[model samples]
Target: MKAKIFNSEIPFYELLNNDLSGGEIFTVKSEGLKMTEIEMGDYPEYSEFVDTDAFRDILRAEREKLRYGDSKTVRISSFNINKSKGVLEVGFHPSSYSVYKAFNAIKHYPPQIFYRDAGHGLYEEGTSDWLDTGITGNLIRANHCGTGLFIDCAGPGGVRVIVGMRPNREIIDTHRLFRTYSASGSIDLDDLTPFEGVLREAREEINFEADASQIELVSFGYDSQLGYFQFSFYHRSELSFEEIVTGAKGAKDANEYTSLDPVAFSAENIDRTVRDIAEAPWEPSALWTLVVLVARLILSDGAKKGEKSGVTAARIDDFRNKLEKEIKNRNYESNFKIFN
Candidate 1:
């Protein structure tokens, strides 16, 4: 339930690995992404926020009224994409969702006793590093798994991407409802790689278990508002749109979304769909996932990218490029803000 705080779009994302290694490199080895344990108690800043009288009161109040899941989260420590090896690697440590929330409140909320560098200080002081600004700014920077679950199916016209409509915010434990891309959630403590987390999230949210070969890396981005690195992916499914929705009724996290929408895999539809989500209440990671997924559809050869190309392969770079083209072609503005 990491909702957007204000009216502005948080920040634009940076690409880690632009495209796949030669072919669309989906690695068989899980070792590419590694994780080590962390002791959150050892971080003094964490203790400060958790121990704060006002913050504790706020947490207690929120807990009494709304639903909050304080599960163990994964934080990226080091990230690298080994193009030559046809794999992407990430090193991360364990964290809790509650810790992430505390960090968020410290940065965005006002009048908290242990408020570090709160509002203006965060923007003005830090360049690339958040440590230059707030008390637990570094901790805030590396938090949660903003994983997207895209369930793709073949349609009469062509491939159609399934989008989800979440009714009550309680489903995601968020502030507002959304028509976000299929599904998006965090990773568990047991997860080793981002793909694994995506799969798990998909299974829970939509009751769809995907094959390893069918899964493709759509894009890697950072959500500065939530302050965590997000990895978005899509799983090509043999199921029809109806079958997929039917299966979703039996999902473990079926309440996460009330219904799913299938959109034609086209540029105009992508633009329209994003505008709908953006104009309403939606999360940053989900919006970016849809942007990148549509970028794969319009900018690249095909949905799955390994076919020898007279058709140029799509790079992760295409996400921003697509947005830029949308902005200019549509006579919009500076960034990929909420609307055009």
Candidate 2:
């Protein structure tokens, strides 16, 4: 199989130039839906997190127990984009590990950097199954999963997206963790699929009560460098802006979110907010997932038929251009080199 590439602007396509064959390319689709999985070869150059003394000590203590091949954790790194149904599905299987082991073995590197770098390279070159044989071992490649919801409310003041400010005590504190977010946690070992996991998280994190039918899966993909899968969900709430605020506030104590912020999804505001998010400390998957949803929404019919179509179109374009630039700059700074 030849290398394949898919992104916000491009449609899913298989067989890249017909130059390679027989290699396992995990791009699967069914029933007018598309999914792609890219294997990120060992990324040994990223030392932002591994270089810490604390990380080293943790690694030293837990290295023996966290050996590769000790347990095969299978995760669903799946992204389903259904244009006909107007939904994107990103889902991941949950797994569990000791908190102490995770703290020491896991790196706090920005996930977006790894995803952007690894996804770009994998898209250009076919998948490879090389594991890093460095001091960090293959621990960085452990399969982790999480769910994020992009809540959109369309009312008198146009469309707004709900965002949550993470509390300081949490692992990713202060940074926004999507509207409502949660990791797979101990529930990964259960029979729950990625879709069910997100639904559970939505209820626990934001008191969001919607049948699975009401929510649509947009797109889902895996980031190999980060050794994790991110499942993103799109939910359009019937609640009024005030109701959403009140409901979200009530659930604040149930989750790690410090406060709820509903951001106007105007083009200008999106452009500014995305730029700010790139600069601020943020959950990488949440930020990128939001970017993907914004790109999809701006092109949807709802956005086009809105009262502010002209302004929305112009602002969406601007936001897209700026976001592309941001991704490019960050990729460059990440110094991600693809090794064959």
Query: Considering summed lDDT, which 10 consecutive residues are worst modelled in model 2?
Result: 11-20
lDDT tens string, model 2, 1-340? 2112122321111111111122111221222222223232332332334455655665566656543322223333334443446444433332244322444244454444334234223232223322111111223344355455666675446655545444434643222233333222222445244456566666666676766556654434343333344555567777865676567555534555556555445543566556544443334445445554564555453355663556544544566567656655555334422111
What global local distance difference test value does model 1 have? 0.55
lDDT by candidate, in order shown? 0.55, 0.43
Say what the RMSD of model 1 is: 6.5
TM-score, model 2 to reference: 0.53
Deviating ranges (above 4 Å) for candidate 1: 1-10, 17-31, 38-69, 108-112, 115-142, 156-159, 165-167, 267-282, 302-340
Clash statistics: count for each candidate: 0, 13
lDDT of 2 at 229: 45
Model 1, 250-340: lDDT tens digits are 7888876667777555544555544443344345566555554554554454445454443333343343444434434553333334431
Which candidate wins on lDDT?
1
lDDT of 2 at 228: 43
